[model samples]
Target: MRITRGLADIVIDSLCRGVFAGDCRRLSLRSCFPFLYDAECSKRSVVLGMVAGGDKTPHPDSPLIQRSKKEKWSQWSLRGGMQTLSEALESYIKDKGVEIHKDTPVEALERRADGRWQIKLPDGSVTADHMISAVPAAEMSRLLTPIAKPMASTLREMSASTVAVVNLEYDGEVLPVSGFGHLIPSFEDRAMLGIVYDSLAFPEHNRRSSSSTRLTVMLGGAWFESSVGDPDAVSKETLLSLASEAAATQLGVKEKPRRAIVTLNKSCIPQYTLGHWKRIDHLFSYIHQHSLPLSLIGASYQGVSVNDCIYNAKKAVQRLTGS
Candidate 1:
């Protein structure tokens, strides 16, 4: 069905900015929402495509897909925040004899003549039969420039958005509503992208009294550099002020927060703009053509969610193990 310009402006634009944190006009429907694009390509109708697609067989090895067959999927959070998940994974892997090196910055990556991957570190270098890069696109591009200039150049072209998270804890409940907060449309021209009701979703994670409320204000996305200026130069105090002002104006939150924290994540979210899929396809083709023992994973290439990363990582492992 053809979407009217009015509807597109009202809904599609808002959704694109909210989900991808980028402008819909600039983002590729094929890259950002492949399901919709695939449906249109194959069935000529998105609705029909979705129906046909759902009838297809699910991957046998996918635990998530299997779980969905028996029960509905639900959003969940760890008891001690997201860090708990990382810690748990670390513990489980440690038991399996995986040697994890923390705080060791990799200076460069070199492909040895023996077809092994050499990782240069501050102290020494380590060689491996295979290498999986999970770093951001820019960093990955920088590291791969010497070995794979063409692929690195392609990676360098991919853009990302910065986000500033301002966490505020008030003495008493301040939110006017009780759900997952709200997202501001790009048309709104607000500094804040959205606000997440942290305590409302996971009350157990609250460190303050039961009566208190915790809010996480998300600022900056595609408009960060243009509107807010340099992220590094922006002060935490300024961010806190912005959060407070947003809270007061939007949610009618006037009370001063007992505690506030500001965190600037530079280029945290990748923008899958037009031709993103083509770029990815080219990168994979290059890898295969060069017979490189390297694999790429993480938010830069595909899905950005934690579940997406885990699913992709599992698929990569299966491929490497010939499972």
Candidate 2:
């Protein structure tokens, strides 16, 4: 089978004509990832292209996709925060007699003569019968380099995008919209990639304050470094300022934020890029050839989202147990 190359190579007529009725040049379908228009669904990994970036997929130009019986649709969220899910999982695992190590970063991985895997940590090392890495491909490459240099090299070539999040609490409803939020198009040339109407999306978010609206403004993605500078180097204050300004302008609100929380997430989202499948195929081939007891999972290789990770984890566990 022939692999479709870059975003430019794919045609965009079928997918987004309604949004961009005429002169599609004004809007690039390549700007959106996993564009539903493609005809070859299998070629384009069933991935969340929006969060990662559009140019990441191998087949950006597949013809429009029809609603499939196989597709499941549901949006799930925890009451407190997304972190609540992790905390609950940690607690549940602990209750189930699983040893949960907190804050211990894995430094390296080595294979022992007995065929067991040794994991190097900050203070010492621990041996495990099997190992599964949920870390980003680049970080995994660093750990895998000692064991499989070629695989590590290929993994390192994988790219990821960083995001700076600015959380702001306003005195009142500052946004014109009353729903989840809005994603800005790249053609807008805006610093903010998207904005989430937290309070509106979830009423619980507003209970903390007296009818105040909370907005999570996300900036920096594929265009971050080019538009703003190094994501890590950019100060919280700067991000807050940019977010506030963008929010105010976009929402047409005059109320200044009562408070702001800025977070610079380095290498946050993986970029699928044009020919990502080839790299993945190579990495998997190496792992299978060596019969490595390592299973790669998470946003880097498969899908991105809490549910996606959970689904992938379950699949991995089944594969490992041969159930």
Candidate 3:
């Protein structure tokens, strides 16, 4: 059950920091790794839980399980890009009579005396019997402050990490080695979090006319303020320079990129800091006590991965519809 300092550091750097974008000391194990936490709680030992609690027998009717038996798990990507998934979802919902209001930010949220939810937009307001909030924790907090101060306070306390993504494309392959990418630990004292070898992993995404290499460098997580300075003040040129330096030092890439792009995502990844589970429990208790129809979902409450969001969304719908 006990691990040496060396092994502990490796796990903290590779698993905790890689996934949560936060240090293991700050991240809540229960919130970030619920399965492992739950297993430890029930089995009284993490190792035992891992060995004994696994799904030993696959269900015969499960298509996914059966397919996995035949095909080994491998990395995959969409044809066009991640944006394609969003476009497809929008099209499907539009066909299903879902009216989407783009670029219309909600200014305020109010609970009507008739037990309905009213959302105030710039132009007008709309009311609904139930509401599912998928916004970030801080934004949700601002909207709920007038109605539920306590819940808003709790939500406001949840912190998020800003990330800068720098994409570089070279005319020819520049990487010395071929693999997914590498993650840098906090101990390395580097501003970069990791790098993704996009061209290698998803060759279909590359330009068909020419052989090119694409790389995505991720910068600034929990240490953004200390390492990279203000996310807003940092220029694209600086990020690109840093990305280039990182590539040159780590991957032996010295060639200038043919094309480059830098994007700053402010407060993108929610940090499930210590006591996150307790805070969420309190939020749910408050919602129950007030009989509020508001349901919270997304990276702030549960898991952060795309799969996690989809699964949670489905569960939320089932709960709301009594299915």
Candidate 1: where are CA atoms >4 Å away? Answer: 51-74
Question: Model 2, range 1-323, lDDT digits (tens) per residue?
Answer: 12244332223322222122112333322322334424224344324433345244333122222222235322345677889988898999999999767899998888999889998888898899999889999999898888899998989887777778888888866677788776665556435577778887777657653678888887767667887788657788788888988887888866778888888888777765555667877887887998888888988876555645777787789899999
What is the full ranking by TM-score, best candidate first?
A: 3, 1, 2
Reference-based lDDT, each prediction: 0.84, 0.69, 0.84
Residue-level lDDT of model 1, residues 1-323, one tens digit each, is: 35688867767777776776788889888888877887777788877888888234234455766776668544567777789888999999999999888889889999888999899999899989999888888999999999999999999999998888899999877788898777887777546788888888878787653588899998888888776768989988888898998889989999999999899998988999999999999999999999989889999998877877887887788889999
Which lDDT tens digits does candidate 3 get at residues 1-323? 34468865766565765676777768887788876776676677777776777323222345764676678646656798887988999999999998788899999998888989899998898889999988999999999999999999999999999888999999977788898887887778548888889998888899989889999998888888889988879998998999999988988899999999999889989999999999999999999998999888998898888767867787789899999
Q: How many clashes show up in model 3? A: 0
- Positional deviation of 317 in candidate 3, in angstroms? 0.2
lDDT preference between candidates 1 and 2, better one: 1
What range of 10 consecutive residues in model 1 has the weakest lDDT sum? Answer: 54-63
Task: Output the number of the TM-score-best candidate.
Answer: 3
Off by over 4 Å in 3: 42-44, 54-70
2 or 3, greater by TM-score: 3
Candidate 1: Cα lDDT at 53: 88
